[model samples]
Target: MSQTIHINRVGLVALALSLCANAQSPQERSPIGAVLGTSTPVEELSTKASPAVVHIEVSSYRTSADDGDEIKNQTLTKRQGSGSGVIVDPDGYIITAFHVVKGARRIRVELDRRVRANSPAGELLNGKRRSSFEARIIGVSKEADVAVLKIEAQGLPTIAFSESNNLKQGQLVAALGSPEGLRNSLSLGVVSSVEQQIEPDDSLVYVQTDVALAAGSSGGPLVDIQGGMVGINVFSLTQRGREEGLGFAVPSPMVRFVYGQIRHYGFVPRPYFGVDVQGITPTLASALGLPTDSGVIVAGVGPGSLAQNEGLQAGDVLVSLDGMPLQNVPQLTWLLLHKHIGDRTRLEIQRKSSKIVLDASLISEPSDPEGSIATIDIEENLVAKLGIVGSARKHGTAGPSPTASGPGVLVVARLRESDTRAELAAGDVICSVNSVPITSVAQLRATIESFKPGDAIALQLERKGKLMYMAFEMD
Candidate 1:
């Protein structure tokens, strides 16, 4: 009896062991267990995406006057800036942020040998140990913050892009870049917001993330877990010069659009509406005797423009475009950006209590008559005399203006002396000089030419959406 009882106990133990083994088998495991069972996907993704990443080194020369007693003596300063880029084509085409390579006299790209060697059309290894290649700028769009570059080498590893429109708010993403000059660094984060407007008047949309982007990370690829590029890491918020966790990126769709346009035309063709418009509030609507507040009012129409030819006059309220309601300048800019030259778009305008529908063809944006100021010699220009380099405030550009409708020249770079007390910054829009209303760079130049060095001038400026007066002395 004891032997039989022991045999039954052994059989029961064997049965329990068999059941446990079967439950834990790979085939018998639940789907959730299978998904959570491995870390290979993320690991493999990082390894796969790393090769196509390139480190961008840019060198720019800026001429600035020394703050010494020798005011007339100027110094040439060589500024070295670094950013990151991604290979997007096998023929060594790269896409990076325009700000990365902007004003750069020379650009060098450093690639991994392993990535180049693995390419299908890659040349066999010789004794050459070089990895850096001199890159040439293909095109740049400041408004979109995208730039294209090309190198002489072929058979480079490239990254694939995911469908940008399908990106979810909470999807997992990895930002690959040289943050703070650290090469090939990866930071993981989820998409905090899919669509974020960086500025009130700007129509450019960005992918907002908490991915810890730093100085050198600009123009780097923001990738997904599947090793697909989704966006280009662009900017992060800084408070008191300290980096913040809030980061933004140009979405892949915009990147691709700009890239294609630049590759084909050597520049993104900006479609021109040739009409200046402003959003109308309820009070402004009542004051203007308009029907509703939810429309844009045409402030000025360009002379001899298609808008003027189509009878779009000032004081006409734009109600809709192509069946979509036009509530603000941004909405109009956004629609215009997606359109191409020669494309016809219907506009519904409210003119004197009557709704008017006008068909207008988009034309290549006419170069600003004041755009020549960009090519003006910095040392000889009046703007430089004020210790700043600035551009005219236009309707579609980024900066602080009441919807970019204010008359001013936006300061882009400040080259002030240490002893100077001017509180002007890069984004400060100079509204006037010496109590004279300044509208364009040409006007600012004319005003500055009327004054001599050491003349104290009152500058009406807008900083961070606040209007303040500053006293600056001409150098």
Candidate 2:
């Protein structure tokens, strides 16, 4: 689960369009339209972009539908799911929605039929596309609902990202993906809204469209008429049980930002400012008798965090960060993600009728902890139910914190690809089970076996120098 973010540089290819076309006589036009029959923009776009719009196949485990007792006792079953991914690199980097591949034991990508026809191997046997490649996860951002994957190939056809903020309402868009296992399906629509929140409290936004999204269309690309990537298709509000014509996509700007972070760090890292801020409201401003009716008011500051260390505290109004004005939480959240570890950023604060500035370095996660790792070759070290092998924590072996002193069982390897409920990594140290400290492999196994099927289990683990809890139901 530990990863370092990096980037595989990609080139942006913009398809140029004619702003105006000359008038044509009735005789010159075809029945639908000469443009439709001839060099249609969408036709050209599909030609250019479809090669990179790949069909993804995933295999994962899901609980069965059964009675309470039967469900608890039954083993998990495998599920086959299909989605679409857009290749973004010539070296075979593909981007798709995280949900499409979440908890997947295996992932495979099939290139477009046209690409398969020209297979370098010169033949298709077993009815398989020679271009089909197994994909390895580069990284995933669950919050943003995006995942970057890589296939072993060279000189792949790729779709480049476009500026999503430049998109306006009513702009023509095309949806490309495999819907119902039919690869290279295309649908036309218009931009319904540039940005919208699915939930009132959630900061993540989507580009709304009236696209004809059917089942199995998730993770596809919503491209402009010229074929530039505008967003990755997430979900439709529905054709419902009735047609609502509602669909949404994660904007490309956010995708580009997240894609870069995942490539670099294996995940998106929201930089820590240590100060929590709330948006100023007219009512609150009146109640507090504050100067400005709109601004970010600091609610609290984390102790020992860089902000607290830099002299930030509660009740202070955050006027701006690195000179940009801040007014709302979403804006603040979006801005903070741009800061990386070791980067120094300036914060403008309005405190007690005076403005002051403080510079602080971003460090939400610490450096990797150097420690001894256990070997899983021995049978006695296996924690079979958890799908991991373990060993006792030894003297001088620890996480980043010097204060993390205790007996714990260290994970050696993860054996079950299907049992990823805990996402336990090799270097992780299982410290406790339901608050009871674990000191050996047998103890950990015994503790898990003690629980009944469907019983809740919470494990405290130290991973990559940080302590965190992963909870799941015993099965």
Residues 1-475, candidate 1: write the lDDT tens digits: 0000011222233324433444655566453343234433445666788889899998853444222425432333457889999999988899998778765668899885455423333434474534677888887777777889988777678899886668787666778888888887777666778888764346577888767788899999998868899999989998998756678999898888888888888877888567777767787778878887665788898666668988999989888889998867666877887898888889888898799999978877644312222233334433655656667776455332354337688765555443345656656778888788887776787787787778898988877667788886766
lDDT of 2 at 395: 45
Question: Mind sharing the TM-score for model 2?
Answer: 0.68
Return the TM-score for each candidate structure: 0.64, 0.68
Question: In angstroms, what RMSD does candidate 1 have relative to the true structure?
Answer: 13.3
Q: Write the per-residue lDDT of candidate 2 for residues 256-375, one digit (tens) a residue.
A: 998998788876886767566677778777887777887678788766666787888887887888999986766777887877767888988888788999886676642221111111
* Model 1 stretches astray by more than 4 angstroms: 1-38, 61-78, 117-126, 278-299, 303-306, 314-317, 324-331, 351-353, 368-475
lDDT of 1 at 105: 65
